[model samples]
Target: MVKTLSRANYPDLPFYPERMIQFGEGNFMRAFVEWQLQQMNKQGLFKGSTVLIKPRNQGMGPRLDQQDYLYTVLINGIMQQQLVNDREIITSVSRLINPYTQYDDFLRLAENDELEFITSNTTEAGIAYDPDDRLDNGPQKSFPGKLTALLYRRFELGKKGFTIIPCELIDRNGEKLKEIVCCFAHEWNLGESFLKWLDEDNIFCCSLVDRIVPGYPHDKATELEQELGYEDKYMVMAEPFLLWVIEGPEWLKERLPLAKAGLNVRVTQDMTPYRERKVHLLNGPHTAMVPLGLLAGLETVEEVMTDPSFSRFVNLLIENELIPMLDLASEELRSYASAVQERFNNPSIRHELTSIFLNSISKFKTRLLPVMQRYHQEKGQWPELMTLSFAALLLSYRGDRLQRQDSPEVLAIFDEAWSDQGTVAQSILSNSNLWGEDLTQLPGLVESLEANLRQLEVVGSRAALEHRIGVM
Candidate 1:
């Protein structure tokens, strides 16, 4: 019989006061936020636990409670080109509350004097304004609405406000969340004093979080459980690499004290440079490689890096096409680019090409399009490999080889555009709605795209890649 994980069975587990209220009781919270808190506690930099609140009605709160909020975080991936395999039983989460079922208890947590921070990762869509949410309701349907009501409860008691660090993957997430909360406050007629309190008392710091948490390793659960000598139902698997960039004042760092724990977290006044580095260097290459890699008959990101032709394509695209166009430091860009290459080749990670190929149009718009436009502005020429990737993207959407995993609206547009192959490049590139700008206006874009598409058609992706290499 397997031993259950709980304080009763462990008997030597340490406990701390609940000083933070975390929204979203999912694997990310467990693997990233809670794991960091536990590390801080272990080093004596911080001595507090988190009370998790499930953002939605259904979640893993009950399951977590069953295990006494104790779960193992298995980290398996590459770091600095070395294999890392480690696991730790995280104990920072004190308890969990589902607002829908325990609304009064959820609001009651606001009155706790020990509470100083509130962290959330309710996803990008979770921060939106739902005008239908009401303060008087048992539990507001939206995360912001529930938070607004809780804050009002704290204000009623003249308590101090929280430093809210939202981990939502949106531009200016903290600002957007505050804006929605204010919208709710005004709609509920919470008065000018509450608005002032909301503005002055609270510190909403926008944050960028990067970690791949593959939760509940079911395939290896039995083996892992046997190795641990206990049964853990909420075991989470995550990559070794982690980065959390929080946009806040310097004082906030002292309050959080994550650096004292020796974690890879940065609390800065402006996270713009860091955000740009990630978007341009990390994400840009990931998007650019997908369509081209798929077209070249590659299955995974590892294959792209291992193959000589594809590897050269990535290096040239990053060093020549992407890095030269950015405003960041060249040395820093080069170092980051090197790390990205290693990460792409991580043996533990099998990042499927087709998965990244999902919604290629939108991804290309955000990640690679800017680089293409910038290169054109500075060098007076469109990027060669990027243009080819764009052309390949158009080809992929013709309902051919790769699985079409985008919106039906986008698929329909492509279907209509591909009907007339004679003007397909012209029709797709000129659409402002897809790219947010008339790409056809860019000098020589359509011509280059037409030429690349023709080469891909006549010779094929592999042959075109070889030809592209020979020319460079």
Candidate 2:
């Protein structure tokens, strides 16, 4: 007989009342939010459950339902000079409702007076405006539209307010989402009573979440299956360290108290410091190293760290380019930066550079350009690592033949740039939209970046990085 894994096997797990309505059912939410909720349930800090909503048609809803809303989360990383390995069965998700299929069940959730919180990670693209989206549409096309309809329904049922937390990567995500939702309501002419409820009663929180969840490693299924000793079709692998910072009122701390539950979560009035720390140390280094490191014939982050030249290049980028631009204490920034490097060096996790290289142009503009501008305006000199990193980025965008293949659109952009081929360095540096401003006018940035680009084209990525850093 085939043994089945059931809740009875895990008797210590608690089942609480459902009070949360989550809008996305992807791996990040599963590994992060639901995992945090399970911790809360275990500590008796919050005795509420989550009702998951499939915001889009394509997701893991069917597989999740097949497993009876149960899944395994594996945490792996370094802690106190030891490699920590642990797993838990997350069961806080009480119900999964697909609005596209069961329209009545989806709308009826709005009338539930017990609902106190609404959480979402509907991806950046999900939150958009669709003019055709109406109040009567069974399931609205856009996330903002669907949310507007749900809030209106709750307002009609006597203004039952809930805390709204959005985990999208956009800045001021919560406030922007709320603004868009209200815009939809006004566009639909949902009436003044509903607008009042939206403005006064609800709490829209901006949140910053940090964790690396490489979802469902299908290639290593056999080994994972043997290790787990049971089949888990939707198993998720994530780093051990996690942080969730919510920018909202003090009431949230009293209600949730996630820190009291022994979880790495904080409720604060200002998330700027935390946001800056992550963006500058974590995301900034990742992007800066991708092109330079990958072209050095290194495939993964671990590989880059093992090579002395590339490793030092990354450290210099963080210390010189990114760190000087921030107002945080040097020791605190260094500690966080060290942790980020350790996270990158995890042997178990295989974070691909090609994946991070997607939308390279836009990412560079948003994440790194601001720091470059600040350093130049304040310090009167170009940040060497950042300038060279920009050169590497432009070269990476120019397309490489030996390393790997790129997207056709990416190839096309490079091809167009190559066809003109008139002072390739100057042409690329002059593109204001890419650099967010005319880098040509920035004191030494354009000249330094152009010289580095020439070096990259002549000697290659690794040698160019070493040559620049050696001189410094």
- For this target, which candidate reaches the highest TM-score against the unseen true structure? 1
For model 2, give the 10-residue run with minimal summed lDDT: 1-10
What's the TM-score of every candidate structure?
0.97, 0.93
Q: Write the per-residue lDDT of candidate 2 for residues 243-344, one digit (tens) a residue.
A: 899999988987877888888787889899889889878989888888887677777888888789988888888877787788788998888788888888
Lowest lDDT 10-residue stretch of candidate 1:
58-67
The local lDDT score (0 to 100) that residue 84 gets in candidate 1 is 89
**Which regions in candidate 2 have their CA more than 4 angstroms from the true location?**
8-12, 400-417
Which pairs clash in the backbone of model 1?
none
lDDT of 1 by residue, 72-102 (tens): 9999877887888998989899999888888
Candidate 2 at residue 296, lDDT?
71
Model 1 residue runs over 4 Å out of place are none
State the C-alpha lDDT per candidate: 0.88, 0.82
Clashing pairs in 2: none
Clash total of candidate 2: 0
